[model samples]
Target: AGGQYRLFHRADLIDLLHWAARRAGVRVLLLQKVREVVPGPEPLVRLASGAELCADLVVGADGLHSVLRQALNGDEEPFFTGQVAWRAVIDNPTERRDDVTLHMAPHRHLVTYPLRQGRQLNIVAVQERAAWVGEDWRQQDDPEALRAAFADFAPDVRALLDRIETVHLWGLFRHRIAPVWHREGVALLGDALHPTLPFLAQGANMALEDGWVLAEALGRAEAIEPGLAEYRARREARVARVVRAASGNARKYHLAFPPLRWAARTGLRMAGRVAPGMMLRSFDWLYGVDVTEGSAARSRK
Candidate 1:
């Protein structure tokens, strides 16, 4: 969540993109897929719709199973994380609060947050289990499946599940970070470079961070080569750390032992009670990073 208002929404993200692109005099083409990348001093992208575009630097913002990443790194498959995510959005009638509420239960966790100015709430519930075979992100799942999975959760939480019209289920997957994010004039961005689990809720935020840093990096460079290098150097280790942390979070949130579960919840309550900003401060290193200034200072030195 970007925290633009009290809540975050997909529509808000779209609006931000629309405004930013227009201000930059950029137009985006939707529903077009890149078919191939011709790698060289200058890379050329061949689109499936028989279009060719050439750019000085090609940054792949595509999600998991990125074709650009495949062409650049010789096609690697994403490994399933042995968990499935059931996600949906329910109508938010005016009374819903604007904070994100996360409910953790045995072997599962649920996160709900308002979207569209608290007019709706997006719910994503993840469960750890076996036999989810594929990495397809758009697999359809019935709402009953969600209800059954989360039956023992809090009553208020169960009420939200009842309101879901439909649900999408997908096997969570993880990819090894590309050893190289840049090759000549091409590079990977977002999920292409590091596909993360939803455990940390940092996947989309990381992409936004990537976009912000990337645009700034490109704008600073006198040439594209150093720009790509600088971008990878600044982002690679940081994104990798977040990916690992998200994986660890999944393990922590889904502990099956009763003693462990109670301890974890109790600790969170104590921490939240002791210092609310402590949690916020722990993540300050992430949100407070100034990539442009860091890069500029490094270059000057």
Candidate 2:
């Protein structure tokens, strides 16, 4: 939610869903998981409850460990990214605060964003560590472990973590790019197609863009083949660039060298003071992009 609009919690998804449904002619089904997808002359989907669904086209948005993706492209292993993220939302401090604070230290970063209209704060601390097994997001971590990881951080950071009552920690996993994004009538979306690191925070936004392009391509094409091909061709390069940039950023932000880190911070501080719009303008290719317009419009002779 670092965009122009404010951030929101999971509960706000309801309002978003209602708004989306009203604007777009779509249907949403909850608590239903697609167990398997078979792409063929007629695409077939097997539901968790042994139910079957056949559609002219299938798009997989089930996330990192997408079952539909595994069925469509054969199950592939997910690579551990050697990073763990600890998260929790504590009682908002009585001291009035409106702006979000981002504290970056070598090898670790903490970001706090206002939630529930400033009533609560969403805090996420990410650190690079030795490879950890398991990728369950709901797994809880010991508060001591969280504290120990950031023990060297600033006093304010320590104070905030000290007050946390509940927390969850999960290992991040990176995945290799999909060789074949589409097969027959099956197509992949979001993490299913390209799992990116959290450094860039563009994963969700890219998924949203993919959804729009996928639907438009299908709507315009006479057959599923052309639509799926167009969707993959249009998105692969952009999403690949995003993935590489995010991975590079992870390494760049985790510098432990004293002089280098200092110089980096100083440079950003200077940049913030001078030519701030230039920094924002560098991302025009990203934020100013409108996938609905297609790639041809931006192509040069």
Candidate 3:
């Protein structure tokens, strides 16, 4: 899809959000590790420091391994997708193109895009391998190994890889959406409810949508249960569709058979040349709708 989009550093976005939250008088806590969540009429949050607090409603926006998610629904195993990804940021001195560039190969792909006003480039490389690596994103890997994995890539891509002094490698895993999103004044959002692959670049987008929809649903409802129910109902189908689309893209990008690869490449070229806008329009269902406005319209109706 050919559409104008801007990318920002995660830290910058976080800082902006922190400012907005502070202005709204929201309490921001740091390093308060939650050890347990006791759900009931009034949910209790037990901290690792042995501090306990109760709230009328609790929303868990925690990431993949959410303690609150496990408390609401028993732990379910996450299946490794037989793929691992290395992520790194390198200084961009040449003022690279603002657009994202994807270099695809059999069983692997690399995505590079400029970040921080083109001063840096964010690189995410995924390779399908049998070796089991833990799902921790902070685990460092040898930069030489990443270069070796994509040794056959184009010179431009290789140059970017060469600039990587440090990289973090993490195994990709598919986690089913939580069976129970809301119960007993407790609800889930973001990765705590659905952890999707990065192939579609919609993981963070989906989480943002979840947060907006969750707030809208809760704000309008007279009681917590109904609001939580509405939130799940509005989100589940759309998120599931997005997750499936991302998984399908993973297969499309890693075509190994020569004939299939040729056909796929040719099809993409034809589409880009003949009907580029049509191709972009196809994603209107995914990206066009303003969720906030749509929800308000639905409420009005």
Best by lDDT: 3
TM-score of every model versus the real structure = 0.90, 0.88, 0.96
Clash-forming residue pairs, model 1: none
lDDT for 204 in candidate 3 is 81
* Evaluation by TM-score, superior candidate among 1 and 2: 1
The 0-to-1 C-alpha lDDT of every candidate, in the order given, reads 0.81, 0.80, 0.89
Q: Which pairs of residues have clashing backbones in candidate 3? A: none
Compute the lDDT for candidate 2: 0.80
Please, what are the lDDT tens digits per residue for candidate 1 over residues 112-209?
88887677889999998887656676788889988999999988998889999988888888788877788888888888888888787777777877
What's model 2's lDDT at 291? 79
Instruction: Report how far off residue 111 is in candidate 2 (Å).
Output: 1.4
Which stretches of model 1 miss by more than 4 angstroms?
A: 1-6, 290-301
TM-score of 3: 0.96
Worst 10 residues of 2 by lDDT: 292-301
Q: For model 3, what is the C-alpha lDDT against the true structure?
A: 0.89
lDDT at residue 50 of model 2 (Cα atoms)? 92
Model 3 lDDT at residue 100 = 86
